[model samples]
Target: MDLQLPRGMRDFPPEEKILRDEVIAILKNLFELYGFSPLETPVVERWEALSAKYSGGEEILKETFKLTDQGGRQLGLRYDLTVPLARFVGMNPTIKRPFKRYQIGTVYRDGPIKKGRTREFYQCDADIVGSSSPLADAECVQLALDVFERFKIDVVVKINNRKVLYELVRAAQIPEKFTEAAILSLDKLDKIGPDEVIREMVERGIERTSAERFLSGAQDPQAFKNSEGYRELEPVLSALRDSRVVWTPSLARGLSYYTGTIYEVYAKDSSVTGSLAAGGRYDNMIGQFLGGTEKIPAVGISFGLEPILEVLKEQRRDLPLRKTVTQVYVIPFKTLVAEGRAVCQRLRRAGIKTDIDFSAKGISDGLKYANAYAIPFVVIVGPDEVAQGKVKLRDMRSGEEQLLTVEEVARQVAQRLS
Candidate 1:
């Protein structure tokens, strides 16, 4: 008998799960700080809705894991959050305009797996609905920048305009009918060399001359300054001019719905193979769901929780990655479990993460247990300390000990933690 997860999926153990949670906590806080409220959508979405025009463009559909329910209705796990967001807004209709929302949840992709790509992962997305202003795009940029800064990861924020890319395709003599395919191929420009990109474009039916010409111009943002996309993207870059953002002309976010600016984030000098976060201004997806009478403009950014955890885990090795959230471990001396239980409750009441060894163990063995679980502080409870209304608090890291009253123990631990 074989017990295993499907390909490209993984079960995160405590240490890994703790790191993932840390990333989520930071992103959730940052998302709300910028006026984006929280939103939740079902993990399984209708086949119709998932395949609708509002969904993540054609490329992602290749990875959609389709399923048939017992009732014979078709369903697919959500591949991304932005599509669900569009669907939710489309159905509600009266959701106030310029709705700012953020969602952090599981997303599935049955695509090829790589160093940073996974089949089942988490996306933390923040978006604005009913607005076409580049300021909204700019706001996403600043928010994304803040996110990386908080993580202490050095990254380059890359910006591009889909409109500008379209013009470059036109200028390169690529047929209008093959524009989407051209953009998809161009998206690999940074991954594959220009020669391979041209080869891929040609293989996809683009003329070699046109692919070559487009590849050359796409690398230079100044090549399309006369296009409206360049103008539309100007305000955003201007707003973030001092932020050291790069005008990445060829950033084809690989999504057909990206009607305007596209954003991608990459860690600087890191081995991660893909963008840590990305998004764009998608102005038409929701309208398609709403029957096209009204325009619902939107922009968003999504942070990949897995890739971030990977980066943090690699870059922040000095950070204590603990299996448990417990800050203090209580070891009862001999048959002193009851007294230790009292101390545990007192620490828990003070909002301290406390865990008590219900089975009494020797002081030396208890310290080993606490250290093994990555617990930082250990309280030794014995008959003497119990009678004296005090405990021996030992710092696992420094092995420093202090004999203090329970009140003093809580105060000192809380202060050091803060």
Candidate 2:
């Protein structure tokens, strides 16, 4: 029998794995710089713990993988990081208040298979908890911008408020109960047209009159900009007056947890493809887990690593390349291998990435090996050099050779490499 990974799953080859690792490392560095610590939660949790929260009235429950453990306990792999984060905060109340954290790990969902949408994937997330202020929203936006800047990708961030969405739905005379469905339909606006949105809304049990009004009103920017959604943003807009940002009324995210300012980052040209990253303000998600006893206001964003990777791949752009920092490759005769190893160790202790050829190859072969590895400098040691307390340094790139003492060689290589 031929064994293979399940459909919608992938095994990253070395190059892809290295690229992902590099992206994760860059994210970690920037996240730490922004004062957000890290947190991790279990991949599998009780179905109740995970599902009840997303009752934001989406189809997430149907898309989750439900199963029973050996103990007959109901469990499911988490569909997203945010729900598990709320659970973590609820369980660990002793954690510092206004906790700031970032989580990067894999999440599973039994959703449909599509380009850039998989059954299992990694989400790079950072969130600020216990703060309801728009400043929290602003910082999240700024950090997201920083991520894109670090990646050297030009992007445009679209921001909207769920409250604005609710107000728009109310203005359309849609019942509050049908607001979730309306928002879900609105989320598909980019995929489907206005007519289809109206059809979906009506099919989702919204009255035809209300659905048509909602679609028609939202179609015109002036109408939307003049509605209650616009009125509610007076304070947020005033506060952001000093900070220049593009405002868009069409940024409603599809998640069930977002209670306020939701956002999505797109490539500069919409024709470029999938949303590179997205997230939103989900203030009430913790209430589902902790019963509103704890004061935990939260907002966050996640980098769609795979989608962004695909975008970069299609653009033929390289992520920031990491160079191997080895400054010296030492090759010494078999009899003097210990001396060469000692010298390599000393150079490493002096804060250089240095290695010694252990294959006991000739100096010519060792130089060739260094060139093959793209190592710039090669240190050659033989009986004469060992006796003379000196080593021959050859520049692999320039093919220049020189004789220097161990200390001089170390300093020269350090200077050149640094």
Candidate 3:
């Protein structure tokens, strides 16, 4: 009998691991620079904690990998970091208010294996909790731009207000009872056409006149210029304008926790509906688990690592390839094993990423492996050179060789690599 891994999952090979680590380092550096400290939550949580917190779509409910733990407690793998963050905040209210945190980890779902969508993958998230002001929303938007900028992906940040959508429903005179369904339909405006939205609204019991009013009026900025949502969010737009950031109003992220500002990032040239990154204001999310007593306003953004990688695969010229960190590999001839270890130590002590070919592969094969791994330089030690307190250094890229003492070799390699 043979055991095999399930579908919609994969094991990352060395090259992929290198690339993924590069991405993680880039985001981690930026997250720290932006004042977000790191926080990690459990990969599995009580099912009730996740499912009960948000009234998300049927897909999330059904796709979650649920099972019974040893204690007979129902548990599920986290579908996303946001919900887990909310649970963390709820469980630890004594932590400082307006907490800023960043999390990077794997999440699981049961979606079909496709290019951007995956069953199990990683997500990079940064969130600011305990603030409802659109300034929080603006900061989230800025964070998204910063992450993309570090990755060298040019993107347009799209912004919208759920409050504005609700106000539109009220303005259209849609029945109060049918607001939820109307909002869902409005969320799909970019997916389906305006006509299909009109049809959904009708099917959802929205009046014909109200449906027409929503389709026509919701698209006009002036129509919302004097509305409540616009009034609350205009200052945020003004702030973004002062900083010369382009902000659009077409983003309606399809999630229930988002009560106010919603946003997404997209490539400037692509028409793909899937967002590279997205999040929104969920002021009442923590309160959901905390008995709705304390009002903790919050907003956040998450980058879809897999989708961003896919975009890079398409835009190779614009993407920077991950470079190996090991700067030098010390290779010793058959008789100079001790000198080889000494050379590796000297280079490493000097703050250069150095390693020894302990496998005792011959010099030719060792050099070939270094070339294959893209190691920039090689230090070759042999009996004669070791006796003279010198080692041979070869430039992997140019195939140029020179003999220098160990100390001098380190200095020479540093200059060459630099």
Candidate 4:
């Protein structure tokens, strides 16, 4: 029998896992620095919670991986973190208002896999709920910019509003029934190009001249001030004037729930084909969960972890790599295994990442192993050193050796690594 892994999934080995963890750590630290607290939700959610109305739209719903439990309960893996966050806020209303939270987790979607698209991927999200101020939206944009800046990735943030799209559709005289279809077609402008998008819209029963006019109007920011969407976006634009942001009317985000401002991030020079991150304000989703007419204003941005890593790799950025957790490798002569263990314990107690070779291999083989793992230091515990209550510490990088007490070795390594 041949064993195989599923398509569009991956196994992150040690080196890749370390790089991934480092990315997560950097994002977490930045999120915390921006006063966002961390929160987590279960991977599996009830089917109803992820249906079209709450999730995004019919397109996203179709891509959700639906399943049934042994008890015949319908469930689905969360396609995105925003829907779960809305459900969480609704279930726990006593939580503080204006809640700020960040979540990093894997989300699954059953969709056509491509270079940057996959069935399972990690999303790092930061959101602010219960804030109606456009500052919340601006902050989300700034946070995304900061993340890319930290990685030294040049990016251009495209901003738009759903209300603007609606007005543009109205301006185009696209019939009410075909509005969603037209918007979806427009959303593909980046991928399919203007000509194809116009062709698609024309095929969808929209007038060619009207579609052309609408596309032209969208490119000019001055043409949108009459729109309520323009009014909503004015403050956000003001807030982000110092950043690399542009009003991209063509960015529809392909989400039905985005009631207000929306954003998408693109790498300026990257081999990856899609946005690095995207999100928007969904003012009514939380209200749907509460069964109330009152809206709970919410805004968020999610980083596409896999695509960001791909871009970084393509750019040849240096990523952290350590084959083992051991900062120091302790090798003992055949007779000094007990002493090696004791030394290892002391080093560990002192917060040093220490490992000992239990194979009782020759010193040459042990040194080879240490070098293979790129361990910085190696401690040799042999008969003479044990008798003197000392150990020989070899600096792997420098090939220098020194005889010192175990405590002295620990102190020196700790200070040097620190």
Top-TM-score structure, candidate number: 1
For candidate 2, list the clashing residue pairs, or say none: none
Compared with the true structure, model 1 gives a TM-score of 0.97
Task: Answer with 1 or 4, whichever has the higher lDDT.
Answer: 4
The residue ranges of model 1 lying beyond 4 angstroms of the native Cα positions read 318-320
Query: What are the runs in model 2 whose C-alpha is more than 4 Å off?
Result: 1-3, 54-57, 113-117, 207-209, 226-234, 238-244, 269-272, 311-329, 361-377, 392-418
TM-score of each candidate? 0.97, 0.85, 0.89, 0.94
Q: lDDT of all predictions, in order shown?
A: 0.89, 0.79, 0.80, 0.90
Displacement of residue 331 (Cα, Å) in model 1 is: 0.9
Winner on TM-score (1 vs 2): 1
* Cα RMSD of predicted structure 3: 2.8
Give the Å shift of residue 167 in candidate 1. Answer: 1.0
Against the true structure, whose lDDT is highest? Answer: 4
Please give the TM-score that candidate 4 achieves against the real structure: 0.94
